[model samples]
Target: MGWARQKQQHHNAAFFWRYLLMASALCLVFFTPLCRAGAENHRNAYATMMYMGTPRDYEFYVAIRVLLKSLAALHVDADLVVIASVDVPARWVRALEKEDGAKVVRVENMDNPYKKQANFDKRFKLTLNKLYAWSLVDYDRVVMLDADNLFLRKTDELFQCGQFCAVFINPCIFHTGLFVLQPSMTVFKDMVHELEIGRENADGADQGFISSYFPELLGQPLFHPPANGTRLEGTYRLPLGYQMDASYYYLKLRWSIPCGPNSVITFPGAPWLKPWYWWSWPVLPLGIQWHEVRRQTLGYSSEMAVVLIQCAIYIGIIGMTRLARPSLSKLCYRRSDKSTYLVQNCLKLVAFWCILAAYIAPFFTIPHTVHPLLGWSLYLLGSFALCSIAVNAFLLPILPVLVPWFGIIGVLLVMAFPWYRDGVVRALCVFAYSFCCAPFLSAAVSKIMVALQLTFEREAFLPRLGESNPPSGFNKLY
Candidate 1:
């Protein structure tokens, strides 16, 4: 009887062990995947917006691409989202999704109800589209950004912020250039309703509308992401370090913000100076930094071909003009005083137009979104080549014709002077340089006029303005 009882106890113990093992396997098969799905559903995303119809739509396209590619390079453990307007071209949409790895959220452009606001800028009409970020309910947290925000590091901890948070680059008003928000369909609907009602928007743009919506954000304590990996709830004021205005560094020539991670730099100032314009640099020294990120990512290849083609065209103009110089001079003729005067006035008018063209032509040909050095270089080259044509076509002095070219190079040097203690000093130096150049510029203008006048006196007009023999001194024009 003792042997039978012991064997029965052992059999029961083995059965219990087997049941426990089977239950554990079931949990692994079911519960682990659920946990993963929960984590994914609570995913974070870095989002920015792009709308069409603006004069700078393509520029912003490139800017958004750079921002997305830069974030990808940081290897942030979050999705990249572009809240692109529906009007954005299909090819651009495909590029953003396939090449840049951004999830493009096509949205309709939100009309600004506050368009009548006295200080509204028309360019920001569609910035209201940024409010669509709140409708991205699939993302637990979204750091909605402006394309000008330059990230210095992975700010995944921004995901830890509550429903809404933004950096106050100004004391009273928080900048909308970069902000953290929790996605909520309810909040998005309310924002849309507010837009319909024409809420008190100071700037008639997203910055004003959003700032008014979260007016109390200024009172919230600065957020500090808990070390235990817990996300916070409710509105908060992000430290200034998160959206450190690029202007702050200009005064000190360095970043000195003592709070939070100085992870992103925002250019909330002038639209033309927003880093990617190439001409924005030296003025905004941080532009080069933006370009560096672009160099590593999207690159200038999109515009490089245009630039190369332009350069080729300019070079051809110069070469062909130089070779055709003699033949062009042969077209000169002699005639009566009245006819000569009429011809002279016509030539002067044409020469003035050509000189103006020399200065303005490069503005259209060179890519507007290139590096400052490259942009300025192309401008100077284009100007020189075009000016050379005017010199060969009209009997003008070379030095006076090239004076504007020298002035541009000089202005660039002054603006690019690296030793200025602050922006004020830099501005003063530029002013002084310009003041000094005014006299030289005036003299060059006088010289150019005199040269034009002499051309008509020396190279006489034909009976019909193109029939007379070339003058004895006509060769000097070349």
Candidate 2:
């Protein structure tokens, strides 16, 4: 009888376990879809950047596209957006949508009501369009960005920040290059209203306006995301890592931000120094990382054809000048003594102008957005070609004529040295180098003048280029 009772107890326990397993499986099957649907309904965050139609439109377009692609490569769990003015080209807009996987939001150009303010910069006129970030109420949060930002890693966790947050890269003010904010129509409308009223803006730009709008951001406690995945409320100061200025890294040549993820690097110094400009590299070593992402993504197609054409033209110029040098050397200018002085002065003027053109022409010939090595090479090649024209035309010595080119190279090498202890030291060294080079440059000019005077005295019967001048008289030459 006792054995029979034991068997019954074991059978009852097995029956209980079987029902529990069946119930658990049923709950999972029924509840999983509901949980997923709720998640789908929740508003997503976006990684947003902006573009304005300005003289540098194409440059900014390339910059924003590169930033979007870099963010996409990180697989950040947020939508990528670009707030472009309506004047942006349709082809550019399409490229952003189809090629880069970014949603382009078209906004009207915002008028800077503070334009009449003293010290106002015209470049900041349309920057007021940045206020449109608050108007994107469909997204729960948005990380507003400038195209110059370089992201080192994913920063999706920034979405968990408060209603407004920015990094105080400066001691007394926060940098707006990369900032997190909750999107709200009410806030956006109020901002527009404030602009209409001509609010007091120190810098007459979005940076000043936004800073004024959130005055207490400086005093707020530093933000740390909650472990429970809860988003914070009110304004907060972000850690130095999120918007690390590229200048900061130059001091140590390494990132040492102790708080937050050292993710984004901002180029806030000068427009020309933005990482997208090929020449910005080596000067800012981090620019290489930006270009690597660009090469992987965009691959320089927009400017390549133009770059190739310029290269071919420069090569032809160089070759033609070299081939004709002997013929060119025999050609000379001569005139009667009465007008020889006037002729000599006019010829000297023309020669100086040609030399100046040689130094200036290459800057405008090369495509503005090529790779650094390519851009610098094209520039030097073009300069050499242009200088050759002046050299053969005026019969000047080669080394003195190439002084400006050598000076440019010297400056680049000094700026790109990479071992400065701090930016102040780097700046001082550059200043000292420039001061030292001034005398050499002045001497080069003097040598050029002396060479020009010698050419003026050379006697010739047949004038191929221009009318010849006597030893102390006037004669014009072409």
Judge candidate 1 against the unseen true structure and give its global Cα lDDT, from 0 to 1.
0.85
In candidate 1, stretches whose alpha carbon ends up further than 4 angstroms from where it belongs are 1-42, 326-346, 462-478
In terms of lDDT, the best-performing candidate is 1
- The TM-score obtained by model 2 is 0.82
List, residue by residue over 399-476, the lDDT tens digit for candidate 1: 988887898888888877778787788888889988998898899889988877666545543333444544466434
RMSD of each: 7.6, 8.0
| Model 1 TM | 0.84
Error of 2 at 402 (Å): 2.1
Poorly placed runs, candidate 2 (over 4 Å): 1-42, 47-51, 326-338, 418-446, 461-478
lDDT digits (tens) for residues 26-123 of candidate 2: 99999989997664434555555555546787788888888888888887777788888888889988998999888788988888888888899888
lDDT scores in order: 0.85, 0.81
